[model samples]
Target: MRNLFFILFILIFVSCKEDVLPKPKAYLSLKYPAKSYKKLHFERPYVFDVEKNATVKDSKNNWLTIKYPNLKATIDITYRPIKNNLKELLIESEKLVFKHTVKAEQIVSNDFINESEKVFGSIYEITGNAASQIQFHATDSTEHFIKGALYFYTQPNYDSILPAVDFVKKDIVRIMETLRWKD
Candidate 1:
């Protein structure tokens, strides 16, 4: 009976012995291919280089969406004729960008001027958990005005979507640099 008790106690003690270890840290890694751009000649008043990875869909009335299916994001482009409303359009565009200031950490504005091409505007890069990461307006300062905003389909989790945001930002910059107003 003593030997049986000793065996039972040994088994219980051995079974109770467990190694307490901390879990290893984990991180997400995403990889995207180098972007190849193609000149997109829209029937509207402008032309720009679009990444081949994206598909462009006409929304209506010269408005279009450049969709990145893999990234679940889009660049919404809106075109407007500058009648007597250049002031109004500029005000509206700036207002649209500032609307996210509540959630944005900082809004950086970059002036884009192509005097030879007659395109001039500002690109706003909003950092933080804002609904839109990038917003831009391009105009001939006389006749044509175009604005664009980059948005993700998912909820605005800045940390989680930083990679995709950066990828799209480069594309937006390329578009701004290459944009030409049609005659």
Candidate 2:
């Protein structure tokens, strides 16, 4: 009877231990964390700076900033047609990542023009364990570009901090989807 009690207690304790750990949240939909982001109107009308810090310049000379506090993130949007310096612009963007990240894991590049009569751009996303996505959008011969990156600390042994990374990535996606170059 004592052995049976001990076994039952051990089973209960092990089962209870699993409940302490939280489940990882999957990236679903475009909505970002509200508390950590802010919206600021820019000169380009519908195109706004959804960021904080408001200082770091990206590959295309657009100022980057944090949209909300506690979210260590940035969005750098530069609007110009790709007539000249297209090659130079791409090179500069490449440097921005290679200088910091060890390597690029996954990259998805695409050209798009939204319905808002705004921009057409080649979006580049460089993903790693701690990845950054650089989206370059251009319209006409000139390069109307919005290049942004999201970064977070890589996970340690038993714990993963990539949740924060995933959260910020959602914010980047939200900004990209809503981007519009106004008249």
Candidate 3:
């Protein structure tokens, strides 16, 4: 009689408990450093401002690499002298950017022209699983031509790397905006 009474009491209390509720969505809390830039003092055909946190590597043929060690990403830059091949350079740049169409959802092209600086270019912002999230080309239309692309070390995961993309994007834009062709 005592054992039966104890089992009945336990069952009643267990069945009276509240149901578990689902939790709300949560995201990572990432803190980035403040933005600062310094003029690239390297002896090159062109000059631009780079982020203070980045490391610049000089490569053959006036090519440059701006590495963000903290973000594990690099902005590759290729500089070419425009003789009569401006057409070819522009075509090649567009072709390289469009190659990502197989994976990109959409590509946003923004045209920029600075008359005083004689800098004209187009910036392509790609959204999706594309290998390169950003690609751009700038030129003086007479002497200097520059192309750049942004790449992460890790595999493409747009959602996860979106924040880092935005962070480095500012630096890239800074490069474009401050770019000046050297005579």
On lDDT, the candidate that comes out on top is 3
lDDT of 1 by residue, 1-183 (tens): 999999999999899878878989878788998989998846767889999999999767788899999999999999999998999999999999999999999999999998988989999999999999999999998999999999999999998999899999999999999998788
The ten-residue window of minimal lDDT in model 1 covers 39-48
Ranking by TM-score: 3, 1, 2
For candidate 1, report its TM-score.
0.87
Best-to-worst ranking by lDDT? 3, 1, 2
Q: lDDT for every model?
A: 0.93, 0.52, 0.95
Q: Considering summed lDDT, which 10 consecutive residues are worst modelled in model 3?
A: 12-21
lDDT of 2 by residue, 48-127 (tens): 43544333343424444443335454454554445687776667765665653555565666656564655545556556
lDDT agreement of model 1 with the native = 0.93
Flag regions of model 2 displaced more than 4 Å. Answer: 1-39, 44-46, 49-62, 76-83, 94-102, 115-118, 130-143, 153-159
1 or 3: which has the higher TM-score?
Answer: 3
Q: Per-residue alpha-carbon lDDT of model 3 for 57-168, expressed as tens digits?
A: 9899999999999999999999999999999999999999999999999999999899999999999999999999999999999999999999999999999999999999
Question: Could you tell me how far off, in angstroms, the CA of residue 14 lies in candidate 3 after the best superposition?
Answer: 5.5
Worst 10 residues of 2 by lDDT: 152-161
Q: Model 3, which residues run further than 4 Å from truth?
A: 1-17
In candidate 2, position 36 carries an lDDT of 41
Whole-model lDDT, model 3: 0.95
